[model samples]
Target: MAKIAFILLCHKDPDAIIKQAQSLTAVGDYMAIHFDASAPRAAFDRIRAALADNPNVTFAKKRIRCGWGEWSLVQATLHAVEAAAEAFPRATHFYMLSGDCMAIKSAEYAHEFLDRRDVDYIESFDYFQSDWIKTGWKKERLVYRHWFNERTQKRRFYATFELQKRLGLTREIPADLEVMIGSQWWCLRRRTIEWILDFCRQRPDVMRFFRTTWIPDETFFQTLVRHLVPEQEIESRTLTFLMFTDYGMPVAFYNDHYDLLLSQDFLFARKISPEARELKRRLGVLYAAEGARFRISNEGRSLHRFLAEKGRIGRRFAPRFWETESSLGRERELLIVVCKKWHVAKRLVQRVRQMTDIPCIDYLFNEESCALPDLGGIQSSVEKRHRHRRALVRMLFDYYESDRLLVCLDPSNLDLIEDFCRDRAVTRLLEVECQVSDVFLVGHAMRVGLAGDRTPRETLNRLLPTIRNDMVHESDRIRDAQFDNHLRLREIDPPETNARAIAAFLGVPGDTAETLAETDHLFAD
Candidate 1:
């Protein structure tokens, strides 16, 4: 039988690591873990104790503290790889993973999949220099020519300086040299690991590139493998699934869909806590499937037991499910038409009427709401802000509940509006800034008219780009508009109506506008 070694590199968080190990251990697979030196000593004790019973596991003899911008972490991981290689000398393949990652594949399936790949399946990508970056570099590299007369040369000089400053580099090198980045998590054939290590030993300067590169982990591996390994042997595509973490922030994996961990991706996703239980429960269906789908019993014993247990649990919860669904359907789909009092939100009611005659529930938040007849007090304010936010949350919840189309609008605050609804699974759109004003900061939050009819992936494809582009356009427009607003104020005696007038124009019902104007004395002078 071919041996497979699953290695986890970790810091602190023993509980989470152990939970992950327990799940992995249940499958009776070969596993090893390296707890980083910086992890609390208590955490190491816990980790050591947790895996002590597993014969396949081993704790490293050396540990090191890793700084964010340094190569220590990568080195530590490489060290773990060497150790695993020695221990499982005959092992066919190895998976380099993090403590935070969970296995979605059953041990058997995971092993078989790697066996089929027949090549190193570690997820890595080729780093190509963009044409723009390359085009500018040729003239900049002409240090001895002293031919700095051309505009492109000067531009290149300045651009290179700026990049050097950002990267904290003191020296300049020829730009013709190519660089690459590879994914940190990789599945490697044992031979590939031996070859890459040998190359690193032979070439010291190539290894030093890690000192200055922003993310050395990606680049070091890519550069080495590309230069040393035969091209056909290396796979450029990532065989495993992962959601990229947001830049500069760590610890949150938001709804990433990877095929391997799709079902139980987040089980060991974050540190254990009561607050995250709801998240776990939400993902439980996928969690059970992950294990059962991969368990490699010849008789399919584990799969049958898992499915039977899940079915029993499903039956008991069936009644509560329908009740919850009905309540959610009624509550989720909300119509929030954010306007000051008199402007587009109220007027756009006519447009909405054209779109669909679904007796829309309008929410008004602005300065001058009281003046409108029979004014329903929906003005956005500090006191009513929570109410408005809650309504927004409820509307999102409702949209998901109904799985039906819903729309809400916030003309001014698209960033905040996007924050509230990004995960709401709403078919969302952010209005371009050219269409709105900053004072109307609650950018409109209307459900896309066709959201309910599309699949989740389809909705995201339509909405994410529109929101991103709209935000960029709005930012540019705001910059231009700010300059125009400043110029207009300098030349004219503007009306002294304060926020109330702005509110009145915005379509807030009269009472809310009066309160806004009165509170700020916008009506004075």
Candidate 2:
């Protein structure tokens, strides 16, 4: 009887829930799924049938019909909370999960982490700045101004620019706390779930907002949690936000910002991709990499190897957006650094100056910068000098507010640098330490062990060749066999057999056999 009641919301994608449930089996887990009433009965029936066979699963009643822009999602989840409370009354905690999310940590670590936490691992958010209220709160004064005001819809056609300028927002709103919505994904203690239900039920006005609001699902729950526990430690950056989406979301090393997530530190990433399926198969390798302390050389070396292979033709290839020039014909500026020992920063500045004609600067800090040669000094004072030099490094970065390409040579040390740049709206930051090796493919490997997504056969055809040609070539051993095996399968196997073989080979992230099989035609001539 694990304490965490994993409550899942299943809508159109029963497969996602099924795969998620199946993956949980490795961690000694049980589940409760609330299939939305709007979902096709046939699909819901299939899921129910599967749960019948799975001892860990308890199918929840479909009580509410949730739509994309409505409050039904909130209502449905609340119903699930009620159902889970009644069904698993003895459970210590209740984790609210989506069908698509994949657990990032193993059972032991997750249990231990939850056991120690005092408050619910959940938060609420709302459009506190929206105009409908016409209240005293100046929309401009709120922290999430841009997110509430962004014209994603064409409802008002007049005086928008004039109004924004009057409000004192001169610059284009950058992606910040205001622009981005909170994650629907959350973990909560059982008491918290019960409390939320009681609180929302106590105030029907909160639930009634569905009739007038859009995407209330995103903010309602977040707002409630923040109100209930103002001082509780909350992480807005969910376990899912990829530290870097610039590299087209491939396997890469974790940086400092990721440390916040590591603190909660579950085993699986949110929304693990089919591309990363094979990598997920090797969880032992991934867990080790995720928990590793800062060691520059090791990370740099591993990165170099992985990237070198990424440049090869055996695996799938997607051109990085950075490689292309802007519509203005400006060369996309990129700062790439390989931090070896001392003097690396000096060389970086020199290279940036020489490589481009644009405004360029770099700062390097080392023992040489000190005026007093520590010939007679002890080791402690020498270390202090290095510390002072490190502090000076921030000044150079502060010179530019935004619109600069900042690259750090040692990515293992990138966490601190990334946090510094994230708040600034004008800078585009890229950190490449070394390359990725097989260890970078740990999630893909774990998907192997889990028996990955059963995507359709046709989808695999077009996708497989690219993966085999571009991404998979890094590991000659796997590449050699996989290439031959894929060719043979194309010639002999039907969609189902080929799908299984592909899953077996790639160990895809979660179960996507049906979807992958459909892609088979794309691979054909």
Q: How many residue pairs collide in each prediction?
A: 48, 93
TM-scores for every predicted model: 0.45, 0.45
Q: Over 4 Å off in model 2, which ranges?
A: 13-16, 22-28, 53-56, 63-65, 123-181, 233-264, 274-525
The TM-score measured for candidate 1 stands at 0.45
TM-score of 2: 0.45
Worst 10 residues of 2 by lDDT: 294-303
Q: Candidate 1, after superposition: displacement of residue 158 in Å?
A: 17
Question: Which whole-number lDDT from 0 to 100 does residue 333 have in model 2?
Answer: 30
True-structure RMSD, every candidate: 20.5, 20.0
